[model samples]
Target: MLIRSFDVLPAIDILDGRAVRLSGGKREAPTLDGGDPLRLAGRYAAEGARRLHLVDLDGAFSGVPRPELVRDVAAAAGIPVQVGGGYRTLEAIEAALAAGAQRVMVGTAALSATFVRRAVERFGDALVVAVDVRDGRVAVDGWTHTSELGPGELARRCAELGVVRLLVTSAARDGSLAGPDLPLLREVLPAGLPVLAAGGIASLADLRAVRDAGCEGAIVGSALLAGRFTLAEALATATG
Candidate 1:
């Protein structure tokens, strides 16, 4: 089988129906609006974005995904959309996928072996593990709660449970535009699993760095929303 090269995924995080970015995944952190979620998602599609990373900040913090927004973005983006945040139940997972999300990302719920096994059995590769790392430990509940589990161990377990992909993010680097935590990627890749990196990507160099680190994809947020780099430029760096 042929391996896929790195892909650049544009992010649209929704909070109160507006697109926003949060620093360190902190709910209290000041957020910057990128504009309407639906409009931004459409723009990403028009700009040659191959995939979209859509997050429900409200759901991540509150444990309920905004299904309406997920449906709208999936409909408008005209591309594969992976939706995450507060997906803790099979019903919720099915709802998001039914709403047109090609994949549903789960975090806190992944800590449960029973839940993960059942989810994988039911959703298979459509279920993506959102591995948010904080201080080298797994952080859940919108990055507010740090788990005692190491990321690599969690990843290994998820892979063993049949999860084909992981969306890895460093809470410390998230929304900071400081650059991706290459070391975290190194830690998680030992499972020989495919991963999509998120957070702390500031420039083309950062994008290239993640790609070289063996990430299958990178989810870009604040930097692109801040106009630090164009989506086109980032895509070039990922693909080139």
Candidate 2:
């Protein structure tokens, strides 16, 4: 099998029309605003980010994506952007794509086989499934609700439904900048699908560790926002 080089995705989480970061998936946790979404997206692109990861915090909690904001960011980003949060129905998915998102990500809805199958059939590879983990259990509803399914089981089901890539995130580690939960990543990688690891990536060494573990990509949020490392340094680690 040909190995895929790692990609470092910079995340932009929007809440009430501002970019913010949530610690340990807790909305009440210390939130750091990253300023205007379009400006931040443009800055990341200028720094050499080829792809961007965008999360609609309002949509995730309310179950409705801000299509206009998404459209604005995608248009200004000048790079491929994958959008996630509160995309549950076909119409919602279509709206995101029409808004200029290169790929639409579904979280809660992806737990259902029927939904995933229908989404894949309609969107093909343009759809990505996000499997958020908290304490070894799958989380939904913006990580406020824990489902009965485990990460491995969810990964297997997503693959069976024709999901070409899985965005696996550790809800407990998100924005913590401690380090990635490699064991959790190992569990989901058995399906042999392209997996992107998110949460607790504190430094370039953390990026190296994730790449060495065989992840196709890593999403760095608080680390970059915190100035722990520059995008250029992180991208070099990913490509190295």
Candidate 3:
């Protein structure tokens, strides 16, 4: 399948119903308002954003997803929403799907083999494993919990459980705007597993490097929101 397309997931980091950029992958830094999230999501939709990447800062931190808001965004926007944050239960996942989300992102729940297996079996490829990497190891729970499980091992296990998609993020480089750590991603490609690289993507060229490194897609948040690149520009250049 052609990985790169005229599609880029525009990110909207929702905290207290407003858009905020996490500094150093943190929730307690100066919260920035790119303004109302729903309005911004609509703008991106108008700009040809094929998908909306949304995170509930409160949910990611407190293990409580804002299903109402998730439903609101999905219902009001008329775009496919792929959400990640505190999705620990079947009910939460089902709620998201029922809310019109195209996919549900998995993170802390992956720590439990039973949960991972059940989720993959139940949801199939619609499940995305959110693998937060730090120094080539996996981090969990909003990047506050670090583990010795290497990326390749984690990737292998996730693929074994039938998860077709992986969302890989480098905690160290996140929101720094320096650049994505391609070297780190290259260090741990688990053969056939498809990965979407996230964190520290500063320019359109950064997205190209991600595709060249064999990632399925790249997620841009701060860079896109800050006008360094637009959704239309990024997606259009993803291939040519």
Candidate 4:
């Protein structure tokens, strides 16, 4: 397979200000404790992660963000941070960017075409839309509510709205570490946009598979925290 400029974004999902990884995106699901968020971010950066994917689980569920936490982590990581959770409005997106995020991901609010248009017009490349999938439909509200729109349709809309990139996740595979849903990634790839795959990324081979599937990047959480592979090994696999 031809190698590409694929990035490996080490993920830190914060719940109650501590690092944790949820199975299948469920808050109640079994979590792998990752200790302190700030420490993890710093460690990932030190280990050669090009970017950090930070999500506030509390903010995702409550529709309120903790910008202070984002600020602290972003500052400490010393690398570009992409933040998500509860960024459903222009104000919220702005706050996240102002708080030190290089990019802010919009999930539930991405359902509104008007909101997406406005956000794209305002933020441009700094905006990323999350197409979190469950049962072949888009899952919103922290993966609790399944929308009628399918991933392809939503992906096309995002592309049309001038969205610079997408973060695609399979709700079932998320944290399951079975493997990446390559068919789903293929389905969304036809939209003619760059996609970052998340969920079920368990090993160096999975990283290679995701890169071979033409993903721009992979957002890895559970496997990395579980010691399935180190970030250094993942980066080497992705670049090869």
Candidate 5:
């Protein structure tokens, strides 16, 4: 995609290594996880998606990484898997890598700069830091952990800690299929870095909007997974 020089990273979230939808990115959504996540991952990869976003909803709720399931999806996907959700320990992070995750996203760990640096220094730039903002404040632990940290400060902290990319998702907009908050992106985004703007993306036009606002990509869940839009078509639209 000629999207202001930003790459669009398509999403493939897994609750139980199966395709499922979450309401507001919360676990309360009606489960449609009848299909295997491995198959879904392969589908996305076959569709020309370079990176895949997978979430361990069960693990997130349990405070542990489901190594077996994560490994299964990674092995099957044949592409880089950026896995996240419910990862809070060094052992968990290491296990995720050992399971073949190219990149591991940390939400709760992002709050502590030391932990982020530890993962980054050990794992390098592929280690992504997540900034899940609700009402402009950062939240973690499946959106249960609330913090007073502002987006700009958190982005700066993550950037300073050797994290190459910061993922900014609006909790309010998540899974609403409305759209991303561009004004917030423009205001809180740090210069000279890539911001993965996620949540509430419902159409190709929304992708263009995020690209126009200087976001590298978007994290689309409900819409894309439900077949409201196809990844290949979205890519064609974004790249077109």
Candidate 6:
């Protein structure tokens, strides 16, 4: 098998303008505080992060995005950023891109084929559909609602709609550090679409597993924040 080049995107999840990680995608769950979003972005960039995964946790729950914060982090990180949360419309998506995001991830909106087709037509490769899974079903509305669509079904839909990539997140494993849901990756990878795995990435070994599962990249959160490993170590493991 040909080993594909993999990317390790350090995640900076923002809540109320501060960096935080919500356990298991729960809005009210206890958060792991990661001080000063811009500072963290800069630090990650300095530590050799190729790209940053920025999430507006506040916007995700409230349906109000903070594009200015995205702008600030992107400017501070001085690297490519893929931002998500509350981007349900073309205008909202445009705001994030205008703010400095190289790519914008849409969740609930992606459930609509019309929206997916239009988003792909408008943004092309800049649009990424977030296929957040919970109990084998696609979760949406900031992961508060579970849909009937499965991960594989959603992946196939996005691929058919011309979505450039899918960000597959295991809501149950997110921030738990139990380990990645490789089985979930396997379910979606068969769609023959580019995928970026998120949630429960605990160690370098977990990163390797994600790579071996054929993910285009991995979005790591809690582990990196808890000092489980350095960003340099993650990048090295992903590249090798």
**Pairs of residues clashing in candidate 6:** none
Stretches of candidate 2 off by over 4 Å are none
Which 10-residue span in candidate 6 carries the lowest summed lDDT? Answer: 1-10
Regarding TM-score, does 1 or 4 come out ahead? 4
Task: List RMSD in Å for every model shown.
Answer: 1.3, 1.0, 1.7, 1.5, 2.3, 1.1
lDDT of each: 0.90, 0.90, 0.81, 0.92, 0.77, 0.92
lDDT of 5 by residue, 75-117 (tens): 8888888888888877888899899888888888778877887
Q: How many backbone clashes does candidate 5 have?
A: 1
Candidate 4 residue pairs that clash: none
Each candidate's clash count: 0, 0, 0, 0, 1, 0
Report the CA-based lDDT of candidate 2 relative to the real structure.
0.90
**Decoy 1 TM-score against native:** 0.97
Compared to the true structure, candidate 3 yields what TM-score? 0.94
Q: Candidate 1: what lDDT?
A: 0.90
- Model 6: what TM-score? 0.98
**190-212: candidate 4 lDDT, tens digit per residue:** 88888999999998989988898
Query: Candidate 4: which stretches are off by over 4 Å?
Result: 1-4
Q: Which stretches of candidate 5 lie over 4 Å from their true place?
A: 1-4, 31-34
Lowest lDDT block of 10, candidate 5: 1-10
Which whole-number lDDT from 0 to 100 does residue 58 have in model 3? Answer: 83
Q: Measured by TM-score, how close is model 4 to the native structure? A: 0.98
For candidate 6, lDDT tens digit of each residue in 1-240?
244699999999988777999998998885699999999999999999989999998889987888898899999999999999888999999999999999999999999999999999999999999999999999998999999999999999988888879999999999999999999999998888889999999999999999988899999989999999999999999888
